[model samples]
Target: MKITVRQEKAIDFEDITLLNDIAFGQEHEGLLVERLRKKTPFVKALSRVAVFENSIVGHILFYPVKIVNELTEYESLALAPMSVIPELQNMEIGSQLVKDGLETAKNLGFKSVIVLGHKDFYPRFGFSPAVNWKIKAPFEVPDEVFMAIELLPGGLMAVSGTVLYPIEFNM
Candidate 1:
């Protein structure tokens, strides 16, 4: 199996949307991703595709998320709505995408990363509850559902209160 990761381009938009449908059964996460891209132009497309002999079959996106308290603003990241084609589910493509996103985020100087996802899956990447960093989502979620990984020491230090998503997230 030969697989590669690359930055997404405008041309890949249609194939990527199709791949997302096959991965998640039509337009759910696609909306979020597209909305983010339109609204958060600064988002990094550390996003990747697993090309298996030509057809695009997997995808992921990373976006800017922030922790805002009365006196502080911390730049962080959010991993939302990742999906792989159902047929590709067990093939480690999702794992590769997550690992690639995290590694790229670290190398780019992002301090902390947050994800609202499967508690069981994310911990494999060292994600702990955001509460550990005194951070909470605007909406109430179980402690484990909101997870974070601090890429640097004190990355989340003294960071507390609501975690705000980009306005485009619509959440």
Candidate 2:
């Protein structure tokens, strides 16, 4: 079997919507992806599509985030609403998407990447609870489920206080 992963294109909107709908139903995740695309210019092209059999079987999104602190501040990234087609779940597509997104964020000088997700799931990619770094999500969630990955050395040091995602996130 041959599979390909490519950056989604303007013409791919319909396909993206289809993928999201199948993966997450017609609700929150679908709406969030729509809002993110509508609001953020930095969707990180390299982060969006994972194709298989010429279809978008997996999708992930990363957007700008901020960890405001008294001593230091830096631009960060947030991972949200990742999805894979129902038939493709548990097949590691989500993992590849996340790994690819994080690598891109790291190369782009992003200091950190945050994810609000399942506790058992995200840590394999080096995500640790955000609270350990004194950072937090805007909404209430389990501390272990709000994870952050420091892309650079000591990247999260002195990074306390609320983690502010862009307004589009609708947290």
Count of clashing residue pairs in every prediction: 0, 0
Residue-by-residue lDDT tens digits, candidate 1, 90-109: 88888888888888888888
TM-score of each: 0.91, 0.89
Q: List candidate 2 stretches off by more than 4 Å.
A: 69-73
Worst 10 residues of 2 by lDDT: 38-47
- Top lDDT model: 1
Best by TM-score: 1
Q: Provide the overall lDDT of each model, using Cα atoms, as 2-decimal numbers.
A: 0.79, 0.78
TM-score of 2: 0.89
RMSD of 2: 2.0
Give the runs in model 1 whose Cα sits over 4 Å from its true position: none
